[model samples]
Target: MNKSNNKLNKIIDYIRKDNGINNAIEATEQASLLLILKYFYDNSFSNTIDKLPPFSKVFLKGYKSHQSRNGTGYLTLNNIFDERIKSNSSFRSFKKLEEFLALVPFRVHSIKIVEVILHILDEIQVDESLADDYDNLIVSMTNSSISSGAFHTPIALVSALVKVSKPNKMQRIYDPAMGTGRFFVESQKLVKDDFLHFRGNDLSAFACLIGSVNLLLNGICIDNINIEDSFLYEDNKKYDLIYSGVPFGKPSDISKYGHEYHDYKNSLEGMFLKHTMDKLALEGKAVLIVPDGLLSNMTNGFKDLRYQLLTHFNLHSILSLPSGILLPYTSVKVSVLFFDNSPPDEDVWYYDLALNKNINKRTPIKEDDFSEFISLFEKREVSERSYLVNKKSILNDRLFNLSIPLPTNEETIKFDKAQEIAQLNSENLKLFSSITNYFDVTSRDIKVENTDIRTIKSLGNLKTGNNLTKSELLGNGSFPVYGGNGIIGYYDKANRDENTIIIGKVGLYCGNIHFSEEPFWLTNNAISLEIQDTSRVFAPYLAHLLRGLDLNKLSTGAVQKFVSIKKLNDIEVSLPSYEKQVELSNYFNELEQAKSSLDKLLSSFNEGISLLNKNIILEKVIN
Candidate 1:
């Protein structure tokens, strides 16, 4: 086997090895090494991955074993780790992190390599808390790799603008969340080598490791790095360029370590926006990634944040991020936040990427789609791109320009009243035929992939919709009660939370499915499918490929909107082979297990935040 895979297996074996009853530190150390190496090598933070030899058999066995247990697929696994360090320079104190962040190779590679060694050290019971600090930092970063890769901003989009758009050299660059330092890496291509140094805050100590490695890989010196609690810690610093992807809504009390976070009465985005502005130079440029909800929220607080961002910064341009662009794991809508430290320009350039689309839960994400956004954003021929000018033009066009609409009187008005308006007038109407069509094809294309089973597949039990009481409907619980318009309300008591998923049987919501973790009550609005015998079939596995991406393209009935099992069973099934189907199903089942493991942590999300305050990692298995 190849060296990397061998190493990976060794790491896995170390994590959960069966060495005489209780697990030994050897396995934990190995798992630790795996985590660190994966984080640093990923994203070319270190330049040596492409050349690593194949990992060993024991390592390979462990690698496959962990993968089997984790249910992580090829793309997801591939995105998790890489050893491609490209540059590096040393720095002092806080700047060491920045310098490394700016030119991340040495630090990235070193961190990964050292983390593994440290895991070994931890296994040998090393006493270096400082090394442990760095190790923890790497672990923190590795855990979020799925999301880090998800939000990778291509240099193609931001490179040219950083050089030409902003007219100042020696700029200061900063990111609030700073996952793997995409903004810094992208900025390096556009801005002068020494034009700016990196400054950013992150709740994830692991992201700190990622940014640090990314900076080192880019050839930035570590001495320039400034690490701190961005919201609470004051460095009294200022800069000419600010780039960041501050997280979405406030992650309230989501930590167990009793760390305090920004208690924004408003959304988390607003707080980050203000935080970014607080660090901006008089004529600096700030590029942020914000949600559509922020731009369109009618709340006075949101308006104030916009107003503040506008008055302090030029509010230059708003670029809409393609849907499903952030995470295949999630479908949050996002937009580019471009503005300068000066007053508003005559008109903001709004470039909508036609190639960009919404988050398609139907498909798994890859480098291809997100990379497309970067390429599209980099194309500067704004006039050629579809950008809305006045509110009239925007309303008349019937599309949401991923770009920020020029903040004209009408444009601003439309934004503040965006979600409130109900009239679908020509001024506000959208043809949206293509969007509907896409969803149509996606929902219609069913991959019935388990039909040719040779084994005795039998129904375990078919449960009908429960007669949920009206009072139960009004109760204060979070179990999803599926009905018209999907999850209409909450059910106090749940009937089936684990192992069963609900499918809409009637109405416009027909055919839609919900994954439940508890005994959720289903109203007459949906149908629940439970597998009986799996010698021939495993229902959940079949349900996996069928749930969201399957079923009818059209709503059931105009009046009742109902779908029967007969109709569902009649929809084509695409079973590759009984064995393969079961294999694939088992893989998906493992994924559910891992997800279930993570979901249990949600209850302690607030507790995690507390830990963050004290500079700790929560809910993570430490090597």
Candidate 2:
């Protein structure tokens, strides 16, 4: 076992050192192909030799001859490589290899590299356990680059989904967006049935190639893998089980699907959901990892989709995963939805797998972490982490929001608190205008007096904050980390100490203004303001002024709106005198103090009301 692990590590080290591979995705793909070839070559000598392609022997023979002469022999392996791949084109699983090879950069040292890798593979004994070693190799390579590894699902997540769904013998399984075939490989470990058939598809030909190789490494030869966008294409065959981690946030051009999907023409999640529903067999179950927005979004499209899910399918359970589950790639919170084609259930089970520990690349989710969840899942018992919500409540009260509902006691407290806060905020806004009336009047007077207009550059220096990865942010850190919006998470250290004005520098929240009084860490997603002349411009006052200007209009980028520091610096503002500015700042401070007092009063009021209500109930019961 140690020797096999060492060989796998050696292969990963070799690929990482190769200059030809630009990223982890490329390195992993190359390693997968080499490993698959070795697996098949070794199997060619066994009783299952007939399943191997005829060209397999020829390919290995030519590779060995070329290696013997140190890659300088006149063996002409390029033609052999092309011929072998072409010969396998008739096979569904291997046809995508041609496209995958075209994308891979086979450099001058490629043959020598392959030879070294093949020699190591030959040393390791080929067995069913070897597939796991190959999976570990892929995981190691993919972790080197986050963006490149975004498609690969973490094994722990896959195992949890598999265990929850519970694959059985003689079942047909399918994954529409099967990246590297992790779901299939994990499922195979439990079922171990010859009748268990696997089918999958992916948009990227490279992904299809790697997925095919992954399945083959595990002694599972699937013939129905395809390289096509699952959203646009329609598969007629129904499956017993479907599992997928569909793409989120990317709007698809679903015009080709016709007018029935007019509302969901741009929503990729909606399309995938509709497609999955259509493809399920009479009792087929689907386990999907979807973004949290799909559950609570008020869009007409999302509401309609959720309504269909509740009414048509037997929605089983929802597992809310942690936020940083897909860290470094994206911090979007996701949940698993389990449903089947049977009669609809009146209530749906929900398990909140809220982990206290931070989940990142270094510390990932594990199957064992879900031990309590798995034990309670079958009975659908109510506990601190799990609950049940009726379908009527979801449709009538929530407007089809499927997000896990907060506990009754907690929900009432939060709703009361939020109502109080909203009222206070509305009153505060009114008071803000009255206090800052001097500035508004001064600006109007300046227009008549023809006073000099001051640019932000003259008042302060604007610079983007430093970049910090999601992994760097801690769950229980000392300081908040501000992103494009407000504080995204907490960090261990602070980059800015004083009260500073920040503007969202990119994406959806571009040009949104925020004022941070406490020390905080700032990311490049926002631009911070350092007042050069504090006497003339108070930070809070400047933030309020910029908010009125509608700075989002200055944002650039057709797809992802962003505002550069130069654009912010060029924004013109009508500044009042220093004394007037200080007076306005003082008023703003007093308004904040008033709001703080209101919060304290509301807290006391809530406690008193709770005690009074309890006493009333107890008195009525005694009487």
User: In angstroms, how far off is 111's CA in candidate 2?
Assistant: 5.3
TM-score on alpha carbons, each prediction: 0.44, 0.63
lDDT of 1 by residue, 98-173 (tens): 3323322211112244345334433331112223233333333223322333224433344533543453446667
Off by over 4 Å in 1: 1-169, 189-196, 224-227, 253-266, 356-384, 388-623
Candidate 2, residues 482-530, lDDT tens digits: the string is: 9888888999899986789989987655899889889999998898998
lDDT value, residue 252 of candidate 2: 29
Count backbone clashes in candidate 2.
Answer: 0
TM-score of 1: 0.44
Worst 10 residues of 1 by lDDT: 614-623
